[model samples]
Target chain A: MFGKGRFVGIISSIIAVVVAILVGMVFALISGGNIIDTFKAIYMGSFGTQMGLASTINNAVPLIFTGLAVALPFRAGLFNIGGAGQMYMGAIGAVLIGLYVNLPSVIEIPLAVALGALFGMMWGILPGYLKAKFGVHEVINTIMMNYISIYFVRYLVSNGPLNGVMGTARTVVIHKSAFFPILWNYPIKPVSISIVVAVILCAFYYWLLESTKIGFEIKAVGYNPKAAEYSGISVNKNIITAMALGGIAAGLAGACFTLGEMHFVSNDFPVEMAFTGIAVSLLGRNNPYGVIPAAFLFAALQASNLQLQLFAHVPKDVVNIIQGVVIMFVALDRLITYLLTRRKGGAKGIGNT
Target chain B: MEILNTTLLNQTIVAATPLILASLGGLYSERTGVVNIGLEGMMLAGAFFAVWGDYITGSPWVGVLFAVGIGMGLGLIHAVLTVTFKSDHIISGTAINIFSLGLTGYLLLVLFHTHGSTREPVTQLPYINFTALERIPVVGKFINEVFFNHTPIAYIALGLVILTWFLIYKTPLGLHMRAVGEYPEAADNMGINVNRIKYFGVIMSGALAGMAGAQLSIGVLTQFVQGMSSGRGFIALAAMIFGKWKPFGAMWASLLFGFGTALASNLQGTNVAIPNQFFLMVPFILTMVVLAGIVGKSIPPAADGKPYEKENK
Candidate 1:
């Protein structure tokens, strides 16, 4: 079902890679660092050793879920910027359940996780509903929802019944039963149980997009809602479904942060993961599978940024520069295709913007 | 009662200055079809740059110009991505925001060696004096302090609302801009350069939004701090929607929000004894209430997010 556009897409990808590397070089020079040393530090930071690689992958866990959250909606031609908000809500949900409910390990774990997904689903569904029913833009609503989600968490932890007994804007530590099993006990090895969950999510997402009717309908609606409606597909329903599923993905990301990394709900927990997921999804070309590598690449950059700072005196702001370039590249895909097609003197470009 | 009334009126106008300027900025972009969600980022950058410029130059006027210039530069980046390359507008806008946060934070760390930078005894913009007219009594005190006591830019913001209203409804360029936003292909076929119009709209949006930031740092707060723009840009977006995309109407919408903000802040020391956080939440809660109530009927430009492409079929 994939289009012939993949060929041009791959070629443009190569061009993007070259352009990005060059941009990196230019940035390195501007920052008074040698290009060679920066690349070396980046390598050591991400995958020079087994421990490094694991840390990189560990960081990728949330990115995968968050990326899918965004990419799934894009498939339905919806922009779900509320992933940050949804993800935070999910974290709050899971943390609340994990902290309060005392149940068997298996039961509590799954239940807490489910709460996260449910929270995210609810958050995602609102914007989807607004778009489907009222034609209010999901982009604007989701963005707004993120603020609400963030503040709601603050309010809950600061003054609500859910506030930690210590009077801080954080929840009580989740029960041992609620914790995701850590992969290792080593101090330097930061990898956790969330990686396994993230991988499972990746598989589920692949199946959802490629092997399901809902997924097919989502793509159809995204490509052309009018035609899909004409052809008996309920475009509104599919759009809502896509947004809900996206929310679930984001919710899972939030749960991973709480259950795997923090083990408690704190105000500083999300740490821009929701926003980073948008960048990861965009960089990954909106492919569910592509999110894995894209997330790792970004997470590794984030993970290794401190080391880069130590090695080259190249500040961590350079990572922001790199990410900014990557986003610009991905967003400029249609432009890239146009450039490539023009270079070949073709009668047409690969397709949509 | 008269004294209290005059004081209340003064507070309202003082509170409305930033909102008025920023909302006008929103009007400029959204009316022309490119949703300027990055107005907050642009404003934040402007605030930071204005502080940086003023700190180094010791002239607030130079700082204001510096802010306007920086705002335009940021707008140019948005225009290139959204208008020319046809990137996802929300994503691109979010990137600008993230970038502004990180870039300014990083720059502050590097230059000031601090997270938030405030000048020592920062020089605030000089308030325009109408003291000579104050002898006219209760009405004169109200008029002088409330209306005429603001910085020069506040007056400029009032002018901007009127100017923007005219531009959107009267001028040929404004007509073309609205046409491009409402129906780009139709506008394109009519020989209007949709991309050019979008570029202009975004650039102009940035300039005014930047001025809003300048007002915050130079006029009101007298210093720049990280995340200082806070949610003001989004608040302006809410105002733009509440106003139903008319410039003068947006000014009124902004004033309503500004009134809520002033009320929340003013009640801090009084016996009403509400929590400060509640005060902070007032504008945002009002925004949500406004958006939930009004967004359904507010129609954005027809071709708002759809990046125009030349003939392909």
Candidate 2:
């Protein structure tokens, strides 16, 4: 049986998602599109065939990592909005190693991935250090870092030594030895082994958070820094550790994207995947286990959005509207709970409501 | 030499107009203790609506009004979520930003049948030439060149800087708003309507940000591009913080950033070895340095980012 508190959270999340979809449907109707066809397009785009499903899962791969990146820091009462920047740094680090290091597949792939994680960890730790040492707010710092990382990467690829020889604002194609092998032989898109890595990482994240003393310290600090300090925990240390862990996940996401799909780094590469992770973490309630399904849902929507646009003549921007509304509703979870409880003649002593 | 200085000064003022307006907007919200991170989204909404209004009505002034109205509507949503529901300000802000981007993009496709940007040119806001001033000597030349020949919003932005300083420091309503930000319970005890003051502060921010957006679309570019606000709203937030949440201080900070932007564009024209992107990074890097308190301790409001509840009292 589900705990009453968890049951309420799950029910509210479900309602929020359904409400968002309905809102999207209304938008479709106004645009003179058939609502049923739009819905059908979304379903067909995400799950109509094995290839569609594979692509949907492939899209989820980055979301899962970015979700973990956000969720881990949230557990320590920190918002890691710099995931985009950290992911970029990770990608650049991986690309540098992938293009330069001419080694065996086993050594090169793991090294590139580790370097990516290390770079991401560096980005995450800077803000954490600033917050711990100077009382600087991480939100502003992380946002600032995001722009810095973006511009820096652009400069490197566009005009610096990393520029490709082919007159494009991108690095040279990464070595084939660094490529992640195909896990499944799907006709349309080969499912990269990065999906397996992501699942393993998710399992590790769950184990680390649920069964470790550091995890307890992180949650305790997140709950109340003052109380955690009184209990002899180093709040600063936990903050740094949690941020580094989050960065590591984000960095791995960058590596996965580079080695598994992109195969090279370019200036025009999309960084919005990191932003979608915010929605994912929110929908997941910042829980490691919850992030999987949350990421999957978001990924499916993203994968299907194009099909909806092409087949149903619905604007793909509707997906953005749905995602935005879902986050808004989730943020207003207290209001939803109040309305629901009031309608039910009051539920007594529901936690955090 | 005089021509270069005049051009630089002109560019600086033109660039600073939006920043000053947006920062002043941020100042009001922060002064009333609401962290308005959604200024970016609100400004984007304003920019889009300004173009839409201009495109439909064929008048820039009407477009500016539309932008302000839409911006305030977004502000109202933020007020309800944060003030009424007692939601986290940051979460509400992030949601508002995400919502604005999506909603604006959706509206653009529906109304204009365009992607990425509106193709139609909006009616540009008129400028004051001050031709009489140009006929005078050195002083008049300075005045004509530096203080005139820009959109009316630039003048309005300058005037608002002084007005904001006076209002926040001298007015009774401003006192109540500041008191609410510092300590809502204390303001409540003093018979101030805390919620009303906060709402007004946030809504005023939205209006100003909307104007800033209008300045960008109709006043500067005469067309609305997707994500046209760029990171100016965020830069304004940094200016607000760099100014230590003071109106005059924020204006000066805005000017500094405006100067940085002007310098960046100017340098890009020169044979500088550094890439254009590095110059673009200057504002963001400076923001980080300022936030790190190397410039000074840029402390925020006392009760900032906290949701007030009557039961807690």
Candidate 3:
């Protein structure tokens, strides 16, 4: 089923998976759990039934947004570390529009999503502008912005217009009209409108990269900025546009969480979700196509962690250890290159993806 | 007014010492063209190791040594991953942070059986008496209380700044270090070992930053807790940038930020209308503004995060 090119990618991916499993096993043993039972627990938790499948999809939905958010700027050769900040802003925008507005779902939902996207775009564009205009490394600036967004959101929840009457650091529940209703008979099933929306966005993202002139420019700029500039592609403009678009995608992820799941903005919207997205994008080699599978893999691990804890007595951070191992193995591309060199005639690049 | 002058000034220098040490650590790596975002993790490792060493050995000086050794080890890991293996700097740094959290958290569970570990008051870093230095009244009080009364580590940090200033400007190795950051290709062409210098510089940063962490857990708090470094590493990064990659400039910036922290801490008891959280936000906000100002003009080395390959086009 797999040729040499496909074989290499598959074999490498399999190796990554095996290494990850082993890392998980080591942690499970240390935490006083039998390896086989832990493995079974994780399997059951992730894919035991229809409900498990649905939960996996639910987890993958937000990851898709965050993955695309990171992968877009990465394709343009910029690292968007501020996706966490953008996601928070997106949540804020979605919550405001979802709650305060009294339009029909047909109008209200799209408006809320758009507002979230716009909020994300604005957040990303500031650093993009600074990077293009002033030549600041986006990494440092984006990190600072993450704290700003976190604290700013904290300020809004506590003291600004969104503060609850009880004085706790959270906003009022969003209106039911704005909520993304369940799309399946089973309450735990994986059929939210968010998944449908995510699939549509994924199709759009693939099209944006494969079929568009702007996409070509972004790839060109990423490959070599000087060459792109020489070719009159406006390298700086493309960098800015790609980052802004990337930020919008992250924001949309936040909107999905707000509209689909929680239906409210709280201070405890998992900080690690954004970081997990980083892991997903990296594990997927920052490919938009790869994110779907990568996200599912992580979502499965997360879902399974619940059962693993109950049956195997493994700590939930076992998932983090697995993630760490996967990243470490994937990062050893030099080793992968050496391994593949003998198989090929030295003509094929081993780890370009 | 007199009380205000002494207390505020004293707190500023006291707070500034650790920041200055950490920022100096940042300067060493950054000057050699490595973006060391793992500093926070390294500082945490140092903090934990220091306390662990202190508890075992019953000597804070030994704890300081333990921190330096551990910091160097962590720095070596970063060096191998980013410098030798060509991993992404940010990803490697993120892994370090996550691993530190897990490792420290796990250690806490196993070793201490408490989430937070505290030492008996006996093994604390003994504060110094500066009677000879304190003879000059108001100014003397500020200097003695703020600068002199700190543990041995504070004086070491001040001496390090002067030594670093001399090393960077007055030595051949220093010239090579700057060359490696500014133009690695040029340095490579001139037969300088860029990789070795970068490794030395980064490990040096880790050792110094480890001392900063040691100062925090042993000298001030007398305890080790999870997430103890907080955002000090990032703040030190800000100091490095705000200081325009100069040692003295970083020192001054760290001192200023330290003063801001001291003032904010002092105002908590006062009946002020502003929330204490807003005051907490002051140092970070100032860093943003200062960073933006220096964004274009402050030149990072040409090959800052790009991994060095000896034989590439």
Candidate 4:
């Protein structure tokens, strides 16, 4: 597993991340911020206290789900930019079910989750079907779908039947039984059991991609769809399945956000999570196991953002810049490794002549 | 009957200007086989710089130049990654989008000491009022309402569309770009510098997209709001595809989207029974339907998104 190429990949990723952070620090300095204070604020805000740790884990839950959403489609050579839309649809579904359904905790919770996943699956499959049948590019279709879903949900909460009585563009609070229970309450606003679900899903994703036949086909398709088609794999089926699975993950993220953390769906719910998932998935190299750590790192950064803004005088938007730079560096991973290898007297470069 | 009012037509023209500019920019790069998903980011950078330049220099034209320069800089970065380093085009473009989003927002806070938007308006781009043309016969009313009495950039955008059409179909340079896009190996065999053409195409896209951003900031709004480009970049991409990658086709498609936007805004004020959100979704839905090939098949260039490689001598 630790071959020369894998080792090089790991090293280059580390270098990329470190370089990005340093670049962010330089920007902070230019913006009249003290680098040491900013770093400290970020560190303390994420993991320094029990409250900070809980917030970090809470923030990480949705990221892991969205990361898997991007990763699964990536495994099948699909971009799946519809995670935001899928998540929004999933949230709407969950909110509707959570608001109306009256059942025992055991039944209602699972039902809402399933509905969320199903709604997201439907949204995901539309683009997949379009791509499979009409050769429509998923990137454009997914983006369009995102705007449609966002606006649709906005309409649902703002003016539709589910609109709250408080004059806010939100749904009513979910039933208590439907809420995700606090797995561990260390005095920090009750850490939800959703994190445990996220972990299990991550494990299941790893198993699916590693052991299952469908997973093998998805990976094969991702590697080379033409080759996979020649080898008897149904590339189209894999594309649909991969996207549907990704949608399921994103849908679950929405469900967790509504049922576990926020307990309500609002029009202004953070849609940036879907975009951040792209950064996390790329940083994790799209590996399910790798996403856990990557999600944690990003979650920590996010958890610290407010503190960074308050104490270090750095705007939260700087984190976006850092994430962007990290992604750019990740895209140039091969070049970085090539330079490193060339300096080490290995004449052969990685990828493209 | 008022739905077809001159005000709506004027609004449509205003909305279409940026889409035409950005789509045409996308057309140039895509013609040379480079998929530019970063047009949105380039536009955002342009919007930010346009406002910033106007704020500092007190000249909207200078701000437009600043936006174009910054846009070219971003395009150079994209070209280096996609053309020279042979990075994945989509990933590089996505990075550009994300980078610009973060960089612009961060700068907004640092420079303006505000978040979400720069509330202060910069000098607006000057509108060209043709008084003589407005006094002409019946045609003058149509011309004055639809085309005249607008910022000079709008006229430039319309002219650029025609220029782009002529350049791509009539000129030797256009033929070489098409050759590079359609068959890089063939172009390479004929001694055409594939990388140079790709670079020029992408850089030119950046410049055009930058000007589009300037049009948005100075011509339309006169202030830079975070994510002010909104989905216009993506819409422009759709317009490019809907137009079948032709300059005139993209202009028509852009005009259609602009009409959709204008209609949506118009409906929001009237007693339209449907939710305004649905109106906001019309352009995106239309884009998806177009991409689904329901209207017609919109195929991209054969070599589009593929990196060119030179053979060893």
- Evaluated with DockQ, which candidate comes out highest? 4
Q: Per-residue lDDT for A1-353 in model 3, tens only?
A: 33555456556656777887787788778878898898788778888867777778788888888888878887888877788889999999999997789899889989999999999888889888877877766766777777778878887887767876566888888888898878875564536688888777877877888789988998888877889999899978997998898888888888988998878888777656676777677667666777778889988988886787788877676776677667666665455655875642332321221
Score chain A of each prediction against the true chain A by TM-score and list the results: 0.91, 0.94, 0.92, 0.95
Q: Give lDDT per model, in order.
A: 0.78, 0.86, 0.78, 0.88
Model 4, residue A211: distance off in Å is 0.7
Off by over 4 Å in 2: A339-353, B1-4, B294-296
Give TM per candidate.
0.91, 0.96, 0.89, 0.96
Q: Could you give candidate 4's per-residue lDDT for residues B194-226 as a string of tens digits?
A: 999999999999999999999999999879999
* Model 4 alpha-carbon miss at residue A66, Å: 0.9
True contacts kept of each: 0.26, 0.55, 0.16, 0.70
Least well predicted 10-residue stretch by lDDT in candidate 1 chain B: B1-10
How far in Å is the alpha carbon of A72 misplaced in model 2? 1.3
User: Each candidate: how many clashes?
Assistant: 0, 0, 0, 0
Residue B99 deviation, candidate 3, in Å?
2.8
Among these predicted structures, which one has the highest lDDT? 4
| Model 4 misplacement above 4 A | A1-4, A186-188, A340-353, B294-296, B311-313
Q: Write model 3 residue lDDT over B141-253, tens digit each, in one string.
A: 66677667678887888899999999999999999999988888889999999899999888998898888889888888888877798778778888888888889989999
**Cα misplacement distance, residue B213 of candidate 4 (Å):** 1.2
Compute the lDDT of residue B300 as modeled in candidate 4.
Answer: 80
Worst 10 residues of 4 chain B by lDDT: B290-299
Deviation in angstroms for B144 in model 1? 3.9
Model 1 per-residue lDDT at A243: 96
Alpha-carbon DockQ of candidate 3: 0.34
Error of 4 at A205 (Å): 1.3
lDDT tens per residue, model 1, A1-353: 45656656556655654666576567556656787788878888888867668778777888899998988998888777788888998898799878889899789888988999999999999888877776666766787677767767777777765778666888788888888877775476666788888889888888988898888998888888889999999988998999999999999889878887788877766547777887778766677887887798778887777667778656676566566666667666777777767643332221122
